[model samples]
Target: MYNKTIITIIRGALGMTDCKRLMEERRSVNFFDAAQPLTPELLRQIVELASLAPSAFNLQPWRLIAVRSPEGRERLWRLAQQQPKVLEAPVTLIVVGDRGAWQGDNPAWGELAAMLGGAEAVKPYLAMAEALYGATTERRIKFAESNAALLAMSVVYAARCFGVEGHFMSGIDFAGIKQAFALDEDEEVVMLLALGYAEGGKVLYPRRKRQSYDELVEEV
Candidate 1:
């Protein structure tokens, strides 16, 4: 028999183990099991989980439009240099991000300011938001794009956790994809994810040698 505290710790450890196992096992599978089609429920769940990813001031800029029709997939395949994986993959996801996600009402910052220094402190924070999100410049564009990229990666990871293989792709004609999908001009595709089961036992190609950790890391 195990003690209560030990049992609780064991449960927590098992949860962490499950998460870590999925992370370690996930791979970028290029070939997919063509027999199965990705379901709406699964797509919804994956997006919901991914929305929890950290964003700048909780601006949650990422949006996903899933292409399920064979015809739509065919069009996407053509846009992606006629990649067979785009056609064979059960689900084709177009990930978009709004460049102005932070311009709207920002309650999180106001709340935090109030918490840290009370109501009077929030006035400056509001001005800061106006300056940062209102002025559209190269620096701000890059900032939003960086956060959107992280959120996109989180979507791939979340899908993999649900036993769905993920392939992050950006090799498509951006204008064609937008026109074909009738996407709004304000929202732009940041990435694409091909989701399905792996075609064979192998989930991915073998890892290539990477730069040394020492060379990549700096303590400046």
Candidate 2:
């Protein structure tokens, strides 16, 4: 039998094998039931889970704008190559990466201090963020974007646990979205995820094939 402690940890952190089944069963649902939209509380919980993803120096550069309103969804629809799913889905999250996350020390360090119990507890982490991620603009931006990508995937996985399905879109007009949303110039739009319940008693196919463990893994 499995250790109860280990099983509890798994379930607490990311839920049981059922959560895995949710991910496996989920598909890139295009036709959504906007009428069956996620409640505000549920949306908050999903985003909360997505935010827990790790980031370099704990900067947590990800910023998600959930577009659930009529006008906002319409704008996204136009920016996203006229994809109907943009309009059909109840919420479309625009995940952005803030390149300037490591530029300063006050707010970020303040958060770290609170999280770690005191300023003294996380002073070294603060210094490390400045030393490593603050080296150059390119480094900062790359770190932010990469971390944001991790958070983006987490959003999908987290949403699935709530019986929500999603489809991530690419080739979006980043510039237009920036202009539309008035995002900071230093913020890069990483990706967009359309989220909602599937419509018309939707059925999903098997998860796409991935490289087998032997094919993708290597031992040193």
Candidate 3:
């Protein structure tokens, strides 16, 4: 019976059903049930999935400073152009970009690379990575900020899959937030996300359709 069950699992492995139905159901939920609070484990799970997003030269540059304190939330609300959601949401994350994560040889990358390939095999790649990404300060900051935005989107998508409503907010004073959090001046503020359960049925504005694939995409 165990062997049969294993066979059944293997048979379905390659053709496993997609979660696209859930994806289609997900929308930007502006209204949140503030009473239905999210737990740390759930937040960690969502972040874990988000952290899997792609980055240039494999430099994971995103940082999430989650705010839960009442005082802090109030301050955030004021900074967020006085948005009520900042105070009402169960969890608010301050997404930051670590602009210097890859400029130097990051220990995390070194360890992972060494584990996958030998240390000698990894040195040249690191050298090339540093030269390309670390050649100038501007290049580094741009790539890091870009990566942060991508990761932030991944977090929203991941939270949606986790059955949590995620709202991307850019209504805050970036400099004030950095100062409040004591973040490095050079670190870029990508955006913020409020995660919680959906409240009353959200009334969404009509979404603008995208350009046709042929119009947007060019075949080489």
Q: Which residue pairs in candidate 3 have backbone atoms (N, alpha carbon, C) closer than 3 angstroms, thus clashing?
A: none
lDDT of 3 by residue, 1-220 (tens): 1233333343333323446655566676778887888899999999999999998667787688999778988888888898777788888999899777875456667775666576675676677767766678887777677889998889888988788888888877988888878888568777888888888776876655769999999999
- Give the C-alpha miss distance for residue 98 in model 1, angstroms: 0.7
Candidate 1, residues 40-154: lDDT per residue as tens digits?
8998898889888897666666678888889989989999888888888988888877676665454666566656577566566556655776576664565557777887788
Model 2 over residues 129-190: C-alpha lDDT tens digits?
Answer: 77777678877778778999999888988998788888998869988998899898778888
- Candidate models: Cα lDDT each: 0.76, 0.83, 0.79
Rank ordering of all candidates by TM-score, starting from the highest: 2, 3, 1
- Best-to-worst lDDT order: 2, 3, 1
Off by over 4 Å in 2: 1-16, 114-124, 203-206
Q: Mark the regions of model 1 whose C-alpha exceeds 4 Å error after superposition.
A: 1-20, 105-126, 201-203
> Residue 18 CA error for candidate 1 (Å)?
3.8
As for model 1, its CA RMSD to the true structure in angstroms is 7.0
